[model samples]
Target: MTMIGAQLRLLAWFVIPATLLSGCAPAIRLDEAATDRPIQTSSAPPAAREDAPAPHRPPSPTPTPVPRAFALNLYQEGDFVPQYTFDWCVAASIQIMHNVIDDTGGGTWADRVQQGQLWEMARARSSNSFNGANPLGWAKVLTEVGMGPYAVVSIADYGEALRTAARAIADTGRPVGLVMWRGRHVWVMSGFTSLGDPDQFPKFSVTGIRVQDPLYPYGDQQWGPSPAPNALLTPEQLATQFVVREPRRWSSNLPTGYMLVLPVAKA
Candidate 1:
């Protein structure tokens, strides 16, 4: 009985120390789901911070572009007449102008009867004793025919003169009386081509003009091919015949350089 008791007491001492040591240390628990929890992360990228502000952006600017081309062919509308004689250019030009604004074909200024009347009226107001017709006289007659408020615009620069003429014609939808041959001859400006849109008038530049030279082919030696009545003339080509008015007994009162019988809006 004493030996059995001693063996049991030794076994109890060993078991107690092992149990106390394990209890003093940590307890380890095994979970089958723990490994999967770490690997089960989302496949999507990380979301942006909720408190972050958006970036700023500036506004786009507005556009203001010029046009490519523009033209107004009044002659093509059958509102032009050819001169009967070299000296009758003023009368013919006036007659053609009358046709344009004369919406009613009352035959008031049509044919030789009315043309002769206009010629005589122009001659009566002439500044030159030599030539019965002149720019001043032409303006006078035009005023009498209700196309008044016309201006005798003269510019030294050919390019500026073209812009002025283009703007006038575009605005009024009427022809401009171009004093050609050093103020000795007259031609009608019926249309024009522009680098910018002529329809935008006052805001464009002239590139070319369509002239209704009454003397045409007959005066080709003096003015190039006055082609088909309303001939397209470049600034260079026009400069050939559109020279400064020579000081003459007739054109003494006229301004030098390029001149035109510009029609203005009636006040």
Candidate 2:
């Protein structure tokens, strides 16, 4: 009987714990709970570029474009006039300038009689010019006859001289008078082609020049040949004939240099 009672007590203890353990929500083990979520991993950063500019320094400024090809021309079909006589070069040049600027259909000033009268007018206004029209006389006659407020200028440097002439023409819309062969002859620079626009850039260079030589087809032996009218001559070609004026060749306050009958703005 004692053995049977002890067996009943042990059976009751095992059955009661088994009934409590089979619950509505099961308790998960530590290893089983770890596998419920996905594993998270970290990676290294990318390498930097070697060619990039420094972060602390400011960026450099963009440079202005140079040798940007440009051209400006004022020559027309009928803007050329040949000299009536060897001594009437300036008069013919004045006539050509009048023809260029006038733009009116009928009153062309290329008549031989009119050219002679203009020569006389220029010569009458000059002094210390040996009875011919000098630069002063040429400028004065232009002013009086309503062609200029022109003035005489001398530049020591050849490149600067071309630049000055180009700038004046671009500024005033008038022709530049080049005192060719040391003030003995004259050629009118009607327009020019440059590396940059003269009106826009102060540092432009003259690449080619358009000239009107009154003595075309009759070039001098000592000096170079006269280019055809409205010829676009390079600076080197022009340098062959264009030289420094002799100080004693003509009387002026200007020192010995390349002479130009430059046009100035009217005040």
- Taking the tens digit of each residue's C-alpha lDDT, what string does model 1 give over 1-267? 999999999999999999999998655444645654565577898988999898888888877675778777666456667777777889988988877667765653448677777888898888886857888889888888787767777788888889888888878877889988876688888889988866554557777889877676677564555656777888888888877765465755555668888988776
What digit string (tens of lDDT, one per residue) describes model 2 on residues 1-267?
999999999999999888887774568876888888688766966667899776797779998666677776677888898997899999998888777667668577889999999999888877644778888888888888887899989899999999999998888888888989988899999899998887678889999999999998898999978899999999999999999886685567888888888889878
Give all candidates' CA lDDT scores: 0.78, 0.86
Best by TM-score: 2
Best by lDDT: 2
Task: Provide the global lDDT of candidate 1 against the true structure.
Answer: 0.78
Using all chains and alpha carbons, the TM-scores for the candidates as numbered come to: 0.75, 0.80
Off by over 4 Å in 2: 10-18, 21-63
Residue 250 lDDT, candidate 1, scale 0-100: 74
